[model samples]
Target: MKKNLLMLFTLFIALFTITSVKADDKPVKNNYRIASDSLFAPFEFQNSEKKYVGIDVDLLNAIAKTEKFNISMDFVGFQTAVDQTQAGHADGMIAGMSITDERKNVFDFSDPYFTANATIAVKKGTKNITSYKSLKDKTVGVKNGTASQEFITKNKDKYGYKVKVFDAADTMYASLGTGSIDAFMDDEPVVKYAILQGQKFETPIKPEKIGEYGFAVKKGTNPELISMFNAGLAKIKANGKYDKIVAKYMGNEASDDKKVDESTMIGIIKNNWEQLASGLGYTIALTLISFVLALIVGIIFGLFSVSPSKFLRGFTKVYVDLVRGVPLMVLAIFIFYGIPNLIESITGHTSPLNDFAAGVIALTLNASAYIAEIVRGGVNSVPTGQMEASRSLGVSYVKTMQRVILPQAVKITIPSLVNQFIISLKDTTIISAIGLIELLQTGKIIVARNFQSFKVYGLIAIIYLIVILALTIFARRLERNMK
Candidate 1:
């Protein structure tokens, strides 16, 4: 009986030891956040269902699956993706990003998954642009932060062409269509995809292999992720999945579906109402939330401007001046991209602000500055005697200011506040620079897919006009009520 008990005890110890070792040896599971370009078609783009589908999307997802890893993808724009990865907000990026020497300094790239050439595309049937020399005296367009832009800018002196940099490919393509730019340089596959989708453009110049596309992580970070990507990519390629994904997007078979006439305003709205509504919702939400927060903060600062303490007043003045002095777009970028980078560098910790939070903070700061001035102006407009009378009647300073001064100041500031709200609403469009899909960005996306810039932009303008008009009427009614 004693021998049997000892044997059972030994068996139990062996099982426990084996379990502990296996647990320690097992790889930790992590869901990595990956970023990619929002509108690079055939590489990444929204389908009719509003779902993102493309070669890059499929390829990355396949690799993740094959490697038994998890990932969440953010379809931010190319420049924004690079910013996010550098800021450590994203674990990696696979946005058809070119692996270049300059980029190598900042990013550790996986093995090249695809190679693409930069090509000069001119409006169709334009026989003049046969070579780089033929581009002399022509205005050439390139998307911001692209290898094509780098190449074009470097050779612009020799080519004798003026360079126009667009923040997005949609605008660049639109410029080419409207003849604002004589030609544009873009990835060959992107240009081909655009042509396939009915873009009236032709590449006359021979394409130059700028660089091969690779999955990248920030240097000295996520080395394991790079290894996993390389391994999975090889597996996919070996098993023929890579070729299948490539063929799915870049197949020789042209689409046979009839093109809808989205040129008409009504047609454009009909086709894009879902996206428009989603965008409008975000715009309104951002505007309302930011304005409310700004109002609260601005009122406090405005009171500071009129405070008994000279220091408080001076602080308020400086803050208002500082924020108001900066452009809204710049503020958005700084908050969204710059702040994260700053935080990481100083603390060695990654802190990334999402688009919504960053946009609200930027808009609030900007609007608060103006709102503070309005409040100051309103408070000053009130009679000084009222404050004295309230204080003489045994009211404390806070009570007197709240009951006597602020009530009247609010009435005086109503119109200005309403105007500021309208401005803030319009300003939300600028927040799209940071990749928030507000109304204007939505319109840009639609224009990219359909190439109907005029109709889409016109509709967006009309929507803004209607909303502003309604707000103006509401403000008038509110003023009358207060009177």
Candidate 2:
């Protein structure tokens, strides 16, 4: 009986030791936040179901599972992802980012998972260049911060050509198609994908300059995360999962044999209706909020501009001049991206505002400046005799301005106010530069996915035209009634 008890106790101790060892060996399984681009197709992009699913996305998810870590992916734009990651706001990023020596200073990279090659292409029927000499005096388009851009800049003197950089692939392609550029360089896979989708570009040169893509993290941070990614990538490659992912997106071969449909425009609308509708709804919401806010701000500043106190008038003038001096796009960037950095520097705490709120703030400040001028002009347009006559009738200065001046000024400014509203409505597109996904940004996303720039953009333009036309007619009717 003593031997039996001793044996049982030994077994329990051995089991506990084994369990503790296994637990220690396992990863902590903490959640990590990753950022990626929204429109980098086959690598990372939103599908028709509005879900992000592509090569980078799938690979990261598989790695997360294998490494026993949780992940949250943010499909922001490429620049935003890079900025956030460098700012320590994100754990890591994988946006088809090409590894380069310059980037190595700021980001540590995992093993190269993708080897991309680039080719030069031009619009169909354009002259094809066979040698560097043939590219003399030509302008080529390249995406900003891309390997192709670096290549072009390196060889521009040799080729005697000028380079124009574009922010998005679609924009570069558009510039080429529109004849603004003689030729453009892009990754072979992307150009092939665009060709498969019926984009009218012809590859005239052999592929050159291979680029290696790797997952990245801020320099000197997240070493464990990098190790997990490398290990998981190796495992996937060994297990055939990597090949399967590549085949799923790129297919076994690049082919332009897909049928082009006559009803493609209708099909695009049918497929992207939800995106368009949501974008339009947001546009309208932003416009209304901005206009109302601007109206209030304009009135307050307008009163200040015409106040009896010279200091108030001078203060209002300075504010108006400062705000109006900046372009809407510049203001949007300052409000969205700049302010957070400023606050972070001052307080050592990051305070980031959502894109929508920042956009509204920018538009309000911009519109307020114009509206203040409109209001001041309207008030001045009102006769000085009216104010004097009201004052002689025992009305206080405030009462005279409120009862006599404002009412007439509002009436006089109605047409101009409506026009300003129209201008504000159009200016909402500027917010897209900061990634608001307004109507224009939504259209760009759809174009990125479908490679149907003309169809999608034409649809968006039509929608805008119709809305503006209706507003113009309504404004005309309102003006006639006032008359």
Scored by TM-score, the top model is 1
After the best TM-score superposition of candidate 1, give how far the Cα of residue 134 lies from its true spot, in angstroms: 1.8
Model 2 pairs in collision? none
Best by lDDT: 1
Candidate 2: segments with Cα more than 4 A from true spot: 1-31, 48-50, 87-90, 124-127, 220-224, 253-263
In model 1, the runs with Cα more than 4 Å from the true position are 1-28, 254-263, 385-396
- Model 2: residue 38 alpha-carbon error in angstroms: 2.7
TM-score of each: 0.90, 0.88
CA displacement after TM-score superposition, residue 357 of candidate 2 (Å): 1.2
Q: Write the per-residue lDDT of candidate 2 for residues 1-483, one digit (tens) a residue.
A: 999999999999999998875554345547788988877776777666667777899999998888787899987778878877876667899998999999999999999999988999888777657666788899999888788889889999988999899988888888887889999998887787677666788888888865799999989877777888888899999999988988877884533223333238888777778889999988988999999999999989988898899998999999999999999999998888788878878998767678899999999999999999999999999999999999999999999998999988888998999999999999999988776888988887777777778888899999999988999999989888877
Which lDDT tens digits does candidate 1 get at residues 111-132?
9999979999998999888999
Give the Å shift of residue 410 in candidate 2.
0.3
lDDT of each: 0.89, 0.84
The TM-score obtained by model 2 is: 0.88
